[model samples]
Structures are given as structure tokens and as C-alpha cells.
Target: MGERLAGTVADAREAAPAAPAVLRVIIDAKRFPALGEAPPRHVLGPLRLTLRAHEVLVVTGPSGCGKTTLLNLVAGLDDELDGRIERPGQGRLAYVFQEPRLLPWRTVAQNLALVLPAGPDRAARIAKALAEVGLAEAATTYASRLSLGMARRVALARAFVVEPDLLLLDEPFASLDRATAQRLRLLLLDLLETRRAAALFVTHDLEEAVMLGDRLVVLTASPASVATELPIALDPAARRDEAAVAARTAELRGALRDLGSLP
Candidate 1:
């Protein structure tokens, strides 16, 4: 596994055409005004990193490490900054927020329809997406009627409907029960592998990082910065249940301590 990743890294280092079209992020400096009073606070970053076309980059760190802030920049939600972010293709991008930000007024299916491209056969796509998230039965239900986990699944389905080249997920499985969260993790791995979307996922869970990242990027607490990008040493197939999960958790914990992201 180490040899394979080394080869992949070597290939990434090779020079490509002068006008490299791959999705890359080179944040020379990204600063924004702080939220509260007293002092002129800011989420600052001369932060730098890159996410290749087929990478699943997991960002983790101490509380207030600016995880969500970084995700927003990647999502094009925060443009009130100065930096350069090169997107791989002109293809659409999609985001799954921490909350299930579904429109209360619309039925689950209708909410999903809002993001999918206009086409003659969008219903089929919506159905497929809903099924992928195990929400096919909730298609007719109002957003108000679904449980939090179900609602988040709808948010996920909505994001999936876009068929994005880049998918930004911000703690999408954070507030769920273990069973549900695990199910979503498996589903996510399936989605990421099958669809081949370059994804950047932000989470505080060491286990999640271990299970998902091709390389895990750790950050410092608020006013965040990249601390390390450690290679996750586990087969993607070892993503389920106790044994592999526990081992990965141990490895990740040791790594976090070494990086000073954990106590």
C-alpha cells in the first residue's frame, strides 16, 4: 500500500502540460473579518494545499480549526477573500451541509428536484438518488416529517443528484446514531468510489478520517493552518465494523498526538 501511494505521489509530482487543468488549491492568503466585537477578529490563512482529480482529502484538527471555513472557500460560498483556487473542470460542484438544509415548504422529492439539472427525466434521477441514501420511501414525505438522520440523507441525496466533479461534505454524518452514521459512511465510500468525485471532507472524528482519506490533513485550532498530511494506512475495504475500525482509530490517535492536534 505504501509503495502504491508513493508511486501515485511520484506521478503527481511529474510535470504536466503548462496549463495544468487539474483541480488545485494554492491559498497564498485568505483572510476575512471576524464575527464578534471587541477586537477586529479574522479567520486567517496563507493556507496552502492541493487536491488532485481523484483524491479524497479529509481535513481534521482541534476544535475551531477553521475546518468549515476552508470548506466554504472550496465550495465557492465565500468569495469575499483573495486567493486562487483552480477547479478541475467546468463541471458542476455540489455540497452537503452539516444540517439537512432542505426546504420545509417542499416535499423531500421536490427539494431534491430543486438542485438537479432541468431535464425531461429528472424524476428517475431523484428516485435513484433517494434509493442510494435509503430514502426511497420518504419521497412523498414533507421535510418536516422526517427524522434528523433521514433529513440529512435527503440533503446528501440532493447533493448527489448534481453529479458533481467536486463534492464538499462538511460533517454530513455528525449528528446521527452510530448505526446510521456507519451506514452513511459505507454509502459515502460507495458514492465516492463509484462516481469518482474528488471530495474534501471535514470532520473531527479520527476514525472517519482514517476510513476515508487517501491522505489526512491535520490543522491547528482556530485561525487554522495545515499541520500535516499523513497517509492513511488501511485498505479501503477495511471500512466497516469493529476490527479494522478500532485499529485505524488507534493509529489515527497516535498520529493526532504527534501532530499536536490532540492532547
Candidate 2:
């Protein structure tokens, strides 16, 4: 009986469809201002990047270096850019902006429900996502009543509920107190592990970049291009260790210094 059950499990595993790749490549992509009487101002690109499944690629650069623009292009929010971006046809994308962007009048569950198609299990899915972010009890609370930290968690929960193929984050922790940001970071790491989605995270904070990225991509100022790529070699467990995070942070800083791209 045990042998038969094992064989059945193996057969099911073999019959299951393989997961699709996350993102293909951005080849020689560039973004420029609208063409009019004035000379066009270049915003970003002549850049190239690729992301794989379950990989976290963190982008860091000086302020106004077009990090957000890069993410916009990837998210298909801006197609005016020049170059080629390839994505899997079966993959879905999700974006988490710097702001929570919730409806003031809506409950937390309502805000999350906005993204999902109405189905029998939609409520169950929403409950599970909120629970994952430690917001199980706040499901019925209105957005206006929640604290900033709780609001941010709801935003994250909204994104994860979609089960995206690629997740784009534009400095979601910006302007938060250090303690709050730290807690969110840990929550994000845990969620990322469970979802295993390819992610592109943009941040001005070097520490945040080091903590979240499997590979860090540093960009040049303005009309941005890749300055350097540094791969973090630490184990996943090391990200929770202060010493490990500090060591990786120092290594990244040194690399930025060598490239003269440290902000």
C-alpha cells in the first residue's frame, strides 16, 4: 500500500505543469521625454536587465537617477521607452508603490477585494493574505482608522494576494520610522519566501538593498545605466543576523565606492 501511494504521488508530481519563467530580458531600453519643439530630455536607459523566478533584484542609485522610471517601464506603465522587454505570456505582474494608495472609505478587506475576481473562495483568500501579513483582525477596519504601519501591511497584503509572477516595489518603506520599516522588511522577506516571485525592488537606502536583494544592481546618475552588479552570497538565514547584514552592507558600499556611484 505504501509503495502504491508513493508511486501515485510521484506520478502527480510529474503530471503537474512546470512554473513559467518570471521575466526574459530588457535589451538596450531607453526612456526619453516627449518630442516637441524642445530638445528631448533623456530620463533613463540604454539599459538592459533580466530577472529569474524567485530572484530578488534590488536597484540602488543616487536620488533622481530614474530608478522609479525603470520600474515603470518594466510594469508596462510606460511604453514610450526605446528598447525591448520580454516577459512570459502566462505571467501576471503586480506593483506596490511608495504610497499605500488605499481608498480612504474602504475597509482593509474591501481594498484587497478590489483586485481579486469574485469567486467562491475570494473571501477565504483575502483572509489568508491578511493573516500572512499579521493583519487578520484588521480585515474589517477602514483604511483611515489603521495606523501607517498597518496601512503599509495592507498594501503588501494586497500585492501578495494577487500571486504575481513579478513584483515591482518602489521604495515601499520610505518615510517610515526605522522600527516600523524593519518590521515590514522582515514581513516582506517572509512573504517573498512563500510566494517565490521574481521581484524588482528600488530603494535609496543601502541597508535596505543589502537586506533584501539576492543581486544588487547599481545605476549611474540620471539617464541611468547599470554601473555594476553585486551578488550577495550570504545564506537566507544570514539576512536575519545583524552581523551578516552589516557585512553585506559594507561590501555593497565598498563596491559603490569603487564605481563612484555611492549616494
Candidate 3:
């Protein structure tokens, strides 16, 4: 790869706080149930999260550990969730799920248009977003015609067009190959720097966490709680070596090995 997208940057050097909203999540012992079972079980945050405005907070955990559930609660997607989730004001939020969730019937441009304000500026903004993801040539293409990675780029465009105050991502690159994932990782960092959106990202990859996260928060095995908050110690201009991204991948993997649920 050319260079690690995030480069070696001090975690403290992340974008300056811009959003006025202070986001707090307080869940007192959450419970849910087996997927096919009648009774529910809770495995997510019972603890609280106080995300100081204008920062990226990443949740890294194994599959089935309720990373998505915790994210949903914070996004108000699961209103059935009973918990105190607070925010500054009517701040806008954008969610990028594990799947692209693009509409098959819509063209890339139209799909992107859904997230922008309904006005004359919307179309141009959508086009710009698609270009940012290097999908300008696919503007009129239908979702069904795109590859998984392309579909994901479309999703990224959609999520970013709104210029949301809070951006929530759920394993957005989980299905892509390593090279493709790394490329998008760079794009995401560039976007984060420019958009300055407060982000809550959930991923299982330790390398990804150390690479992108300002503060890496790990959840315990089922019935999750914040188990670790590993702050990255790279420079903003951090790059990779031929061996790997700064050769920190193995060290990060080792750190996560200590987490019993790490895959």
C-alpha cells in the first residue's frame, strides 16, 4: 500500500471538537434473548458512555456481542430500548450498517439524494459525494449492477452527504478484501477529517481499530461492558512499512489476544 491512511498521528491530534452536542449513553444492565427463543437476553451496555463532542469512539468486539444493539440504542433506531441516551440538540445522525442497504431500484445518485436536504443543492451534493468515493462514473448505475465494494462506496456517499453531527458505522468494510478495505479506510479517515463528524464505529478488526480509532473501546463477551479503551499512539502522518502498517498490526493483534472474545 502507498501509506497507511491515518498515518502515524497522535490520537490527541484528531479533529478539533466542532459539534456543540455532548453525547451520553447510559444503559443500566441491558438484556435481550436468543435469536429463535421466546425469552430475551441482554448482552450490551449496562454501563454508560460519555462521548465528549467531536471525537471518534470505536467499539471493537466479537460477533454476537451486541455491538449493533448498543449502536442501535444510541441512534434511537431501537426506540423499544429503554435507556437514557442523551445528545446536545436535534443533531442529525447517519448510520452505515454492515450491509450497504442500498436501494436496488435507485441509481447511485438518487440513493445518495435521499440523505441530503430536499432542495436544488441536493443533486449537486450527491454528485460531489459520489465523486469523493471515486464513484463519479457510476452515478447513474443501479444498485444491482454494482459489486459489493462499489455498493459500499455508494453507502458511504449516502451516509456522508447529510454531513451529520453523529456518524454511526457498523462493520462497514467487513465483507471487502484486505486491499479494498485498506483503501476505503483511507477514504474514511479523509472524510472524517473533512466532515468533522463525531463517530461511533463498531468493528472486529484490531488492526482497523488501532488504525482509525482515536479511542478503541472493547466490549466484554456477551452481556457486554466496556472492557478496554486502547488509545492509539500514532502520529497524524503515520505511514506503513513493507511488513505492514507500521508493523503495529501484530502488536495490536497481541493486545486484543488478551481479550478472551477476540476472534
For all the candidates, what are their Cα RMSDs to the real structure? 5.0, 7.6, 8.4
Model 1 score (lDDT): 0.79
lDDT of 2 by residue, 194-215 (tens): 8988899998888887778888
Colliding residue pairs in candidate 2: none
Q: How well does candidate 1 score on lDDT at residue 113?
A: 94
Clash count list over all predictions: 0, 0, 19
What is the TM-score of each predicted model, taking all chains together? 0.87, 0.87, 0.85
Candidate lDDT values, in order? 0.79, 0.86, 0.79
In candidate 3, stretches whose alpha carbon ends up further than 4 angstroms from where it belongs are 1-21, 33-37, 239-246, 255-263
Alpha-carbon RMSD, candidate 2: 7.6
> Of 1 and 2, which scores higher on lDDT?
2
- Which of candidates 2 and 3 reaches a greater lDDT? 2
| Shift in Å, residue 126, candidate 3 | 0.7
For residue 101, give model 1's deviation from the true position in Å.
0.5
Model 2 earns a TM-score of: 0.87
Give lDDT: candidate 2, residue 203.
89
Q: Candidate 2: what lDDT? A: 0.86
**Ranking according to TM-score, highest score first:** 2, 1, 3
